[model samples]
Target chain A: MEVKLSLFGFGNVGKTVARVLLEKEAFFRERYGVEFKVVSIADTSGTVWLPEGIDLREALTVKETFGKLSAWTNDYEVYNFTPKEAVQEIDADIVIDVTNDKNAHEWHLTALRDEKAVVTSNKPPLAFHYAELREEAEKRNIPYLFEATVMAGTPIITLLRHGLRGDTVGRIEAVLNATTTFILSEMEKGLDFDDALKEAQKLGIAERDPSGDILGIDAGYKATILHCLAFEPITFDMASVKGIVEVTPGEIERAKAKGKTIRLVATIEEGRIVVGPKEIPKNSPLAVESHENVAVIKTDLLGKLVIKGAGAGLKETASGVVSDIVMAALMMR
Target chain B: MEVKLSLFGFGNVGKTVARVLLEKEAFFRERYGVEFKVVSIADTSGTVWLPEGIDLREALTVKETFGKLSAWTNDYEVYNFTPKEAVQEIDADIVIDVTNDKNAHEWHLTALRDEKAVVTSNKPPLAFHYAELREEAEKRNIPYLFEATVMAGTPIITLLRHGLRGDTVGRIEAVLNATTTFILSEMEKGLDFDDALKEAQKLGIAERDPSGDILGIDAGYKATILHCLAFEPITFDMASVKGIVEVTPGEIERAKAKGKTIRLVATIEEGRIVVGPKEIPKNSPLAVESHENVAVIKTDLLGKLVIKGAGAGLKETASGVVSDIVMAALMMR
Candidate 1:
């Protein structure tokens, strides 16, 4: 089946996805058996779409020079319209919801009601209204995948959702946030918190404002998602756990003396939410993990299933987005 | 659906599988929507099979006492046969193959040909003829999943098979053998190679002969499986890689003092087969992974799909067997 997609937001993830599709367009159809067309791209700059189709390379080069796609002046029509209305009328098999809109709740309700299966790198909807969204999806029998929203390209969400359907998991302990972990790791190496934060910012590991990542809010949202997926009713919010941006360099040094690392660990204990910075053994999966590496999940039957890899990056995050798209495609009727 | 299974080998992995089925009976059915039942078990001693299904707990107890099922002297007809034949005739929806009969490739061939989907913990047949078996499975459309065969219960097989299907991977680097890695880790900790090997043997991480795990043959088999899933044609064999098993404790100490660890690594470079020991930084994912933990594959697209966990444990291996059973049931048309 051919997929006509209207991609919203041409950020790092979106650009990488576009590039990957363009590079492997032929290979995917020939080897893996997938066909996709990114017909539209919309961002805050404005919307630029080709009804017939647009060349990925040309659009990419234009965006690089002009800073935003709206600057590209071609024969393509510029239907200055809100993204919500545009998505409904797009005539697409799927909609790539990569918008910067924080109100993911609105997107899910709107796009899903239109019978358009959504594949996103967004975190808000799953964090806020997992139950309602899942119920609606079941009723509609449509797939809503957010593999990038949690662990970038790690497939943590899919691992919990589909792969672990039959497994018995008592709890999941994860260092879901890579930015904070990276900052904390650098801080342990004698770099002050502010300097580490600056380094993380330069590396594009943290938010522009850095508030969501620094305040533990980002990791907290992931915990909520993980809790909902692994346990039940992801009412567990990050507010329950103390955020880590306030931790001083002195405190980090104190912890390091004992051969420990301050990691943002999210776990379910007796069906309750447990999220905080705990002292993990240096040789433990969590401590050894550097940069944006995420690890440490213990299940009832499988015991400890430890995984470490890139949690966030242009390439890694794009990998997650691609995974969601593929999964939604597979589940399509 | 009730899954009547005829379990063979009655070894660590086999016994662990039986335990998971008995304990997680309700969880499996309610969660996965499938019921599991073990009808017959075979060991060298004798056979204990209940046409109606015997008590798993009592059967295990009987096996422990006699070292075989024949010690019980039950009134029911005892059919002494290889698990291969038992699978063909026994009324079973799935066959659990956890036997260590490596050269007995015919056993795997017979089981799959009989229309009974196989879930194996053994790497023998898969290493020898993965393509042939996969072709047979394609013709039959039954899932012959061996997630445990590579990184026990880490979902590496699924990662390669389905998770990253849409992406084109350039290369894969892995520490596939747990026994060799364990011995090498201990050697780095000041123990000589002989002492480290002895410790591994005592912990049951190493076999009595220890050739397969020690001489890199175990990793070789796993690499072949990875090659089959990742590359085209899959022509490499155990003889291809420059195997590493004879490093001394002094070398391990030298590597460690320089803030690195020595790991016997198997890697695929630009579609070429490569395997050997190399020094890794202290914070590398593979360096931090110790004991029975296994980490493998740094794909070009999906960076470090590192799965670290109990590479080979009785229950973990058993859980994988049961997982394949549930999948086989789900795949039923």
Candidate 2:
């Protein structure tokens, strides 16, 4: 059976996902016996519908040259359809939500209720409305995979969900945000807080409006999602979040003098979620440098399972979304 | 659907698996919607058959007291059957081969031929005849899962096979054998090679015949299996094996003086598999300490994904086998 995919975002991640799907089309067919086609793609500007599967190469070129699907004058039909309307209208097997829209909760619900499996890199719906979406997906017997939500392409979600099934997880200590970690590493190198923030922004690692990252909201969101998945149901508001905005070079140096380093650590233990700058031993796993994200999951049976990788990137996150698509397809069979 | 599992070993790992299955019966049923039954169990002494599923609690009690199924004079009948005969006769959906019998290759083939899915911690069959067994399992449309063969319960196999499906894997640097790693770590603490081996043996970390581990043969076998699964098809002999038996404390101290640590590293790069004590930076992922295993997987899309966890333990290895059973059952549906 061919898997029909409808993408609800046309940003860098969405376009990179499309490129990977197109590039690995043959590999998927030959290895996994899965044939996938993107039938529709929608962005903020417009929506393009092609029930017979859009030509990925042409769509990529069109999107690269003209930043919106509405500008494409190909065999596809362009329309002014909202994400909700696109989900309701698109006849596909899966809906991929990569848009950074915080209010795509209803769109995801509609897709799940319509019997379309949902794969996403977006975190808002999962952070706020995980229980409802999970209940809907369970009721529909479809997958609601968001592997790219936390550590980009790293397989932490799947590892915890499926790989370590028999083990009881005790605690999770993680560095989930890349921007905050990068800033702190720079601070350790004698750069002041402002200079570190400027360097991060210059490297495109931090956005102009870095409130979500610097305020610990992003890591709190991930912690909330992880809590709902791994431990129990919890909302983002319940987490005790403290960001790296208050971390000064003097404090970093003080910790360094004591053989410790300050890192933005997200932790979930005993039903308490905390995301803040914590001073850890220099050799601790949480003291990872630069943009490297690490999660140390303490389990009863397997000890601690440490996974580290890139926390944020266009292709890295796209790889996770595509892998989820393949997994969803395989599970669908 | 109820999954019927047959055990071909009554050793520590196998008994621990039974205990875990009995313990997590409700969790598996409620969470994964999976109901599993142990239909048959066999050890070197005898075999016990139960088509309608044996009482796991009683079996555990009897095995704990008597050390073998043959001594259990309960409601079940005991018969003297070879592992091969047991696999051929047992009416099971899956056969779990956990026996340390290195010559149980024919029994695995028989199980596969009899249309039973195979889950194992045993490495001999895979280290020798991976392609043949894989071909047979594929021909029968059954899963031949051996996640416990490499890093016990740490999610390496599933991570490489399912999680990292979209990325192109480039290189793998790993510390796979815990005994050698433990010995090396002891040597790092100023013990000679002989004294370190004696310490490992006293701690039950190394066996009396520790040639397989000390000679790097164990790591070589794992490298072979990983190579076949990840990179390409290759036998154990194809790998360039170097043991840690010749690694002296002098060499370790020399490396330590240079800010490096001696670790028995198993590497697969450019289709070459090498297992030997190598001097790595003190903080490298491969420089894991006692009983801890680490794998650094380099991929094109995700950069390097590092995973570290317990490499060897009865419960840990059993956890991997049980997880594979659950995954196989889920896939069967």
Candidate 3:
């Protein structure tokens, strides 16, 4: 089976996805009996479409050298071909959205309208329009998977949906955001909030304007997505949000003195989603290491199942998106 | 779609599976659009086969009251009908083997030869004959699923196979046996090994003769199964093993004083399988609560992923088996 994919976004995660796909092409074919081809790539600069499949190695080199897809010397690049146009025009089986674009949902809807499956690592589309987008895909009998949205490539969503299918989930306590967890863990090491945030930025773990992460919106988006998937469809606004700004180093020290750790935890239970800095026992599963995410799902049948792993990283997020793409391709077959 | 099932066991896990299936019948039908009819149940006493579908509630009541399917005061019970006869003569789409019968692999082979999918919570079959059983099912294009074999309902196998499909796994450190973990945790709390064994037996966590669990053979079987799934196939005899018989309370206390916990850990890496009591940081993910299992998978792409949950419980194992049944039904569709 040949699966053609159109990726929207050429940032670190998108570029990493292309690299993984290219690197694992033969492995995928031999293991899953499927060949994945990137039919189009659309970024802020422009879109590059090739029905014969875009040269991912060349695209990576072009984007890295020139910082734009349209700068490719090849004639396949089109300056005005927007993401929406790429979704509508490209003859692809699945459309992958790794962009932070607010209007990425529109492209997702357009792709679903064209009866193509959508796989995304972008949380906004799911955190905001889960029901609408999910219904669109369901109506078309297509997949709209975002396994990377919550905890990168940890497979929490798959565990909840497939592994624990008939089990009733009671509560979920999670450390969802890598940025806040990293900051909080650093703060536990006696680093002040400002210094921790600066270190996160230097490591590219946080953005230049880290308001989304510091303010808990990023974790809230993830909480919303998780709540929607595990329970019901919930918009970001429905979640009560709190961040790590108020968690001072003194407070972290105080918590540590009591054998506890202050972590930005997300609690989803009884249709209520809450994201805030909470003090958990240092030995609890929710108190994971720096930058790692953990979801402690309390199910009626299986008790508490903790899934902990890398919550952020270019390769991790790309791994998640590519897995989603593989599942989508298998579903198509 | 209706999926016919033949259950080959009537112990705790098998009975729990029946109860769960009966309770979740409507849920499975409404969710997966498949009605699962348990057509036959073969136990030590005899076999009960109903062509249309066995009345699970009545079967449960009869088994509880009479202690044997053959003792049921109904026309369906057949005293002379062995498990082999049931597998060969009965019409079932999927055969579920939850027995500890050493020759359960033969029934699985027969099921595969008849082109029926196989789901099992039995570890002996896979531990001793993984390649043979797997090849048989693969040749017949049938699913020989054993999600419940290792960590009961933790879904570690699925995580390695499907969740981390394209990623390369580096090493796996797992606390796979609940009996030893419970014993060790009890020993850490000042109980002697014999006292802890008695407590575990009283709590039904360990068998009367728990040589397998205490001698590390149980964990060895699970480790062998995990190794075969994550890497190449290896029987239980190919791995090095050490049980928990020698870990004294003094030793556990010393480890605790050093902020470490003694867990019967299974290490599978570089084609080597080792099961023994390893001292790890008390704060590590592998140092889970009593009766809990944790699998720390170090993948090339995702770094380390830890999955922790109930390692042994009737309901948890039932959940894993039923989920596999659901997946098998979906695949048949």
Candidate 4:
């Protein structure tokens, strides 16, 4: 089976995903029995459209060398095409969205409407327009997977969706944002909020405009995605989010005095979805180290299942995207 | 799609699986778009044959009350048929092996040869004959699933096989046996090994003949299953195994004094598969509480993925079995 793909966004995560696809092309073919080809890739400048399937290695090198797909002289570049136009015009089996662009969901929906499967690491598409996108894909009988949205490549979403099938999930507690967790851990070590944020940003774990991560919107988006998958469908607005921006050094010391540490935790239950800085026992599974994500799922039958791993990183996020691509391709078969 | 099942066990795990399947019948039908029916169930005494579908609740009640499926008077029973005969005679879309019988693999192979999917919580079948069983199922293009074999209901196998599809696993360190973990934890609390074993047996966490749990054979089986899934094909005999029987109270106390606890840990690398008592930091993710299992998988790309959950218990084991059944059913569809 040949699974052709159109990629949206040529950012770090997108580029890493392309690199992984290229590196694992033969492995994917041998293991999953599917040939994956990037038919088109839409970046900020333009779409590198190749109906014969883009050479992923050359495309990645071109983007890295010139910072734009339009600079690829070896390919026919559609300079006027946006992601929406690329999705509408490209002949592909799947559309992979790794863009942080707010309008990524439009192209995602467009792709699904055209009966193309969708795999995304982008949060907003799922955090806000889950119902529309999910319904469109379901109506078209195509897979719409976003495993990397919540916890990079840790497989929490797949675990909840498939592994725990036939079991009732009671509640979910998670540390969703690695940036907030990293900052909180640094704060526990006596660093002030601003210094901790600066450290995280310096480490490239936080974005230049770190408001989304520091103000709890990123965790809120993840919480919303998890809530929709584990329980019901709800947009990001349904979740109540509180960030770690107000956490003080003194508060960290006070928590330490009680053998506890403050973590930015997301709690999802039957009727409640909350993301906030909560003081938890230092030994709690959710009280993971810096950059690690943990999810504690309480199931009626299986008790609590705790999963912890690297939640965010270029390679880990790409691992998740590639895993989802393999799944989507297998389903396409 | 209607998925017919032939159940080949009636012990605690098997009975719990039947109950879960019965309770979740409506949910499975509505959610998975598949109707699951138990056509024939072979226990110790004989086979309860129901061509249409067994009344699962009634079957459970009969087995619990009479201790044999042959005592079910509501339907005709095959008195002389063993599991082998049952697999050969009865028609089913999948064969669910939850039996501990030494010859269970024979029936499993028969089912696969008959082009029936196989879902098992049994360890010996896979730990001893994984190559033959897996090859048969692969040749038949049917799912031969054993999620419940390693860490019951934890989703570790699925995570390795599907969730981490494109990534390469470098090593695996796990607390695979809940019995040993519970015993060691109890021993750490000042109880003798015999007393701890008796307590575990009293709590139904260990079998009356608890040699498998105490001698590290149970953990070895689980480790072999995981090794085969995560890395390569190797039987239980190929892996080095050492039991916890040699560990003393003094050793446990000394380890505890060092902020470490002795756990029967299974370490699997490329060519090394070792299961025995090892002292690990108490704060380590693999140092889970009593009756809990944890697997720390170090992947080449995703760092270490730690999964911890109830590794043993009737309900948890049944959750794993039913989850595999659902997966096999989806594959059959």
Candidate 5:
């Protein structure tokens, strides 16, 4: 059987996902007994449509050079379709949403209503409207997987969902955001906060608009999504978030003097959610290095399980999206 | 729908599985839309056959007092049947094998041939005959899951099998044996080797015949099983095993003086498997506490992933078995 995929957003993460899918096309077909085709792609500039199947290789090359899918002229129809319009109008078996837009909730709900399996790296829909989206997917018996939303492709979501069945989770403490973690590690080396932020920007670890990364909003979104999946449903507004924007050199030195390190930790325990900078022991799992994410999940039956891996990267995040695509394909079969 | 289960080995892990299943019966049915019943239980002494679901509460009570399923006599037929004979003769939808016997290969093959889904914590079948057993299960389209075989309910098997589908694994270094880990931690605390071994025995962490654990045979078996899951097929005989019996306190102290710790590490890299005592840095993922197991898997796309959790315990091992059971049930549905 063939699974037709409709993709939204052609940015860095989106292009990487396309490249990986094309690279591993033959492996999927031969091993998993399923073939995949990218039928439609929609980005900020325009949309490209080929009902039969778009040439993924050509699409990636065109997007790489021209930064838009509309520039691809390989005998395909192009239109100025917004992501919402593309999701509602395009006919595909699965929809891959990689857009960072905060208002993509209605588009996801539309896809689920159309009976299409949705796999996303975008956290806005899941963080804000998890309960509603889940209800829609469950009503349609379609999958709504967002493995790449939390910790890139580390399989934390899948592990909690499928592997730890029948075990009750007690609490979760995690270092989720990578940008702040990088800045904090730099600060620990005697660099001031502004210089540390500049270094992170030079290294391409921090975004051009680093407000979300520094204000604890990114980690708060992740905490909301994780809480919805692991324990119960909670919206993004319910979390009490505090970012690392207020940390000073004196605080870092004080923590070091006490044999501790300051890490921006996201904690979900006993129906309470908080994201802030906390001082923990130097060797604790939460005190990870720059660009590294770690989560320590306490459970009743299995004790404490610590999962540590890369929190965010282009290829890493793409790998997670591709893994979800494979899972959705298998489930469809 | 109710799924019929036949369990072998009424030991610590087995009884805990039964108790957990009964305690969570309503939860499974209401949440997952499935119910399970233990129809038959077999131990060394005899077999208890209850086609109409055994009383799990009573069975646990009886096993707690007598240490055998043969002593339970509410209203079930007891017969002298070997594990292999019971597996072949019983009409079950799934078979749960927790027996410690290292020669239960024929029994597992027979269960697969009988078209029964097999979930096991026993490593012998997987460590020795993984290729053969997997072939049998694939031929019949049944699930042959052994999640509890390696790390005891930590989700390593499921992560490799279902989660990291599009990623390529490069290497794996793990602390897999809990008994030796406990003894080594004690040795690190200035206790002599003999006193550490005695403490481990007194704490019920090591068996009376601790050759399998102290000699690295246990870790070697786990390495074989992990190899089969992650990379390719290989039997237990292919691994080069060396136990920690030769490690002295002097060596540990020497390593400590150099800011390192001696740990029994099982390594699988570039088609090679070895289990032995190696000196690693103090804060490495492999430097875990007593009774804690950690696996650091290096992948091409996802970078390095470290999973740490309890390696051995009654509840932890049973949680893995129950998780597998839930997976099998979902697959059946």
Candidate 6:
């Protein structure tokens, strides 16, 4: 099958997914007998359709110059397209949704309902509209992959989905945030809390607002997703959760003196979800690393299942997007 | 299709595989819509076949007392029956080759040749007869899985065979041997190397002779197998490499003072395979927790890929056996 990929975003992750597939094309075909055609790119910059191939260099040039594909007008109209129109009518095997969060963008919701194979890093769709999206995907037997949503390139959801699919997972515990963990690690090294936050932001490790990360909302969101996948699915509002911003560098110093480190922990126990900061002993596995690292688990008949990896990174996050595309292709097949 | 599973050895991994399958009989049918029947058992002691269904409890009971199915009188009589008489002749849909490593006896070779789906934790057969066995399975068009052969259920081979199949792996730097890594971790922690070796033996973490692990022979075996899978179809002897058994605790302490932790690193760079202890920075993921943890790569267009999990333990190892059985069933359908 000639795989046609309808990419829904052109951000760092979206671009990386495209590059990896194009760069490793031979490896895929020679080894797995799978191939892909990058037919489209859609983002705020604009939309471009290069049916046979999206000349990545040319596309980058076009987008960079005009700041939008819509501004680029040439005789290259062989497969000209728009974002919403592409989702509706593209003769593609999979529609990869890498769109940034916009609560009102109903294109993806409609695509899922229409049975398009979706591979995404966009969490809003799943976080807010999981039921409707999942129902439609199942009803039509198309795959809905969101590996990048929870943890980039890590197999926590999959470890439970396939590795322990039938077993009843009782509890899940994890250090699921890297920005805050990085902040905490830095604080341990004597950097003041405000300075540590600034350093993380300077390194592009934390968001500008840093509200989602420092407040623990991001970890809480990921934990909610983990809970849905690991056990029975449930809906939880992101508001009721408290973030770890309350914990300061002073607390970190106190803990380091006692041979401990402060880490943001997330858990689903006794049917309730929790996310916060905790003081851990020095020798524990959680104390072993710094920077964009994350680890968590599922407890069951198999014992506590643990997974740790790049919680966030340009490349690591992009890896998940590519993984989602791979899975999407498999589903289309 | 009636799925018949033949046990070539009623050992720990074999029993655990059977046990989980039996325990999850209803689950297997409900979730995957497949059923497994323990149709045969064989060991050096003797062989037995249960055409209808094996009294798994009774089989376990008898095996515990007699050390083999060959020693069970009723099972012996039942053994010589048509199903039993055809110990070598029994046509099974899948064969669990868990025999002790004398290259896991000829039964494994026979199982592979017969085109019966083969899943084994035993390293010898796969290590020595990889090409031939894989050739036979390919000719017969059946699945041959040995996830346990490398990293147990740690997802090592699965990543190559499926997940990372499209990515060209440049180097596979690994901490492959758990026992040796564990011993070294203890040595680095100030335990006398000899005393740590003794402690490992007492804890059943090290083999009686400990040559395979301490001498790096076992990890060498795994590295060879990984090389064949990741690099080219190649065979090389690992005996010539210097092993970790000679490292003293004083040496470990010295390395630690220099901010290093010891890990048995296995590397394949430009077609050469090397396995030995490398002192890592205090924060490398290679400073893994406990025994049986392994990390590896797919060093191509997408960069380094790492996997970590239990590389040993009966239940963890048996999970691979079950994965094989499931894949075999998928192929049969």
Model 2 segments beyond 4 Å from truth? Answer: A74-76, B33-35
Alpha carbon lDDT at A178, candidate 6: 79
Please write out the lDDT profile of model 2 over residues B1-333, one tens digit for every residue: 799999888888888999899888898898788899999988888998999998988888888898878888759899888888888888998999998888777888898888888998999899889888999988988888998999999989889877877777889999999999889889989899999999999999999989999999999999888888777677888899999989987899999999999888999976799999899998888888878889999987888899999899988898899989998888677
In model 6, the Cα lDDT at residue A210 comes to 92
TM-score of each: 0.88, 0.94, 0.94, 0.95, 0.96, 0.86
| Ten-residue region with minimum lDDT total, candidate 4 chain A | A73-82
lDDT of 3: 0.87
What lDDT does each candidate get? 0.73, 0.89, 0.87, 0.87, 0.90, 0.70
Q: Per-residue CA lDDT of candidate 6, range A1-333, in tens?
A: 578888877776776777678677786677556788878777775567767867776666666676666666673453344556777876677888777755523666567666777777776666566677777787787878777777666545555554543344677777777788888878778888789899999998887899988888777778777777765466557424666667776788888889998888776764578788888888765663554444545433334344566667666666667666776776576
Task: Give per-residue lDDT, candidate 2, residue B51.
Answer: 96
Assess the local accuracy of residue A208 in candidate 5 as a C-alpha lDDT between 0 and 100. Answer: 82
**Which candidate model has the greater lDDT, 4 or 5?**
5
Interface RMSD, one decimal, each candidate = 1.9, 1.1, 1.2, 1.0, 0.8, 3.6
Q: Between prediction 2 and prediction 6, which has the larger TM-score?
A: 2
lDDT of 1 at B199: 95
True contacts kept of each: 0.47, 0.71, 0.62, 0.80, 0.83, 0.03
Predicted candidate 5: interface RMSD?
A: 0.8
lDDT of 4 by residue, A45-153 (tens): 8888888888888888888899888888654766668678778888999899998888788988888888888999989988889989888988888999998998899
Considering every candidate listed, which one attains the maximal DockQ? 5
lDDT tens per residue, model 5, A118-159: 999999999999999999998888999999999999889999
- Candidate 2 residue pairs in clash (backbone atoms < 3 Å): none
Predicted complexes: DockQ each: 0.45, 0.71, 0.65, 0.77, 0.81, 0.21
Per-residue lDDT of candidate 3, residues B137-215 (tens digit): 8777788898899889878877876787657788999999989988998898889999999999999989999998999
Report the CA-based lDDT of candidate 1 relative to the real structure: 0.73
